[model samples]
Target: MASRVTMIAHLFGAMATILMLVWLLHYRGGIDLDSDSNSDRIFNVHPFLMFFGFIFIAGEAIMGYRTVAAERKVQKLFHMVMHLIAITLGIIGIYAVFKYHDEIGLSDMYSLHSWIGLGTFCLFGLQWLFGFFSFWLPKSSLATRETMKPWHIFGGRALLYMAICSALTGLMEKATIMGLKRGNESRLINFTGLFILLFGLAVDLSLSLAY
Candidate 1:
C-alpha cells in the first residue's frame, strides 16, 4: 500500500512538473535569467522556480525515507542535500520576483501572496538551519537527537504545506491580476494548482506512513 501510494505520488508529481513547464515555457514564453529587460519573461521564472525548484524539491526531500531504499545515514544525507538544493533555488526564485517588480516599476510586497511567500521562506530557512546545527554541525547527543526528531519532522511537514499555501495564493494572484484569458488559459492554471496541491498531500502522506 505504501509503495502503491508512493507511485501515485510520483505520477502526480511528474504530471504537475510537465504542466507547469508547458505553461511557463509554451504559454509564458519560457524563463529568462539574464534579461530583466522583459519583465514578463522574468516573471515567468518566479513561478517555475518557486513551484518546481522549492516546493517540488522539498517534497522529494520529505519523501526520501520512503522513496529511497538506502541506509539511514544515506537517507538522511540525501534528504539534507535535496533540501539544500531547494533552498538555493528558492533564493533565486525570490530574487527573480523582486527583480521582476523592479523592472516593471511595481512596488513590492503589496500583495497577500508576497506576504505569505516571504514569511514561509524565512521560516523554511530557519527550519533548515536548526536541522543542520542539531543533526550535523556539532552532532547532538543521541538522546537529544531522538528528542528533536519528531519536532524536526513535524516542522518539515508544516513548512511544506505553508509553501503550498504560498504557491496556491500566488497562482490566484497571478491569474486574477493578470486577467488570464477566460477559457483554456485559466483552466490550465487551475489544473496546475490542483496538481500542486495533490503533490503536496501525497508527499505528506508518504512521510507519515514511512516515518
Candidate 2:
C-alpha cells in the first residue's frame, strides 16, 4: 500500500513540475535572472524554485524512509541530504522574491502569502536543525530521541501543509496581479495548484500507511 501510494506521489510531483514549467515558460515568458525586467524575471524564479526545488524535494525527504528499502542510517542520510538541498533552493527562492521587491521598491511581507511563507520557512529551518542534532550527529540518548520523535513527525507534517498553503495562495496572488483570465495560463496555474495539493496529500497518506 505504501509503495503504491509513493508511486502516486511521484506521479503527482512530476505532473506538478511539468505544469509549473509550462505556465512559467510558455505562458509567463521564460525566466531570466539578469534581464531588463528584473522584477518580473526575478519574481518568476520565486514560484519555480519554491515548487520544484523546495516543496517537491521536501516531500521526497519526508517519504525517504518509507519508500526506500535501506538501512536506517542510510535512509536517514538520504532524508537529511534531500532536505538540505531543499533548504538551499528555498533560500534562493526567498532571495529571488526579496530581490524582485527591492527592484520594484516595494515593502516585503505585506501579503498573507508572504506571512505564511516566511513563517513556514523559519519553522522548517528550526525543525531541520532539531532533527539533525537530535537524530544524526552526536546523537541523543535513545530515550531522549524516542521522546522527541512524535513532535518531530508532527512538526514536519504541519510544515509540509503550511508550505502547500503558501504555494496555493502565492499562485492566486500572482494570477490576480497578472490579471489572468479564463485562459490557458489561468487554467494551467489552477492545475498546477491542484497537483501540488495532491502531491502533499499523497505524501502524507504514504507516511500514515507506513506508520
Candidate whose lDDT is highest:
2
Model 2 quality (TM-score): 0.96
Query: Which pairs clash in the backbone of model 2?
Result: none
* Top candidate by TM-score: 2
Please, what are the lDDT tens digits per residue for candidate 1 over residues 1-211?
Answer: 7777788788887888888888888788888976745678888889999998999888888787556899878988888899999999999999998988888799999898899999999999999999989997656898999999899999998998999999999999989987887787788889999999999999888887877
Per-residue lDDT of candidate 2, residues 35-153 (tens digit)? 67545877889999999999999999999966668989899999999999999999999999998898989899999999999999999999999999999986689999999999999
lDDT scores in order: 0.87, 0.92
Off by over 4 Å in 1: none
RMSD of 1: 1.4
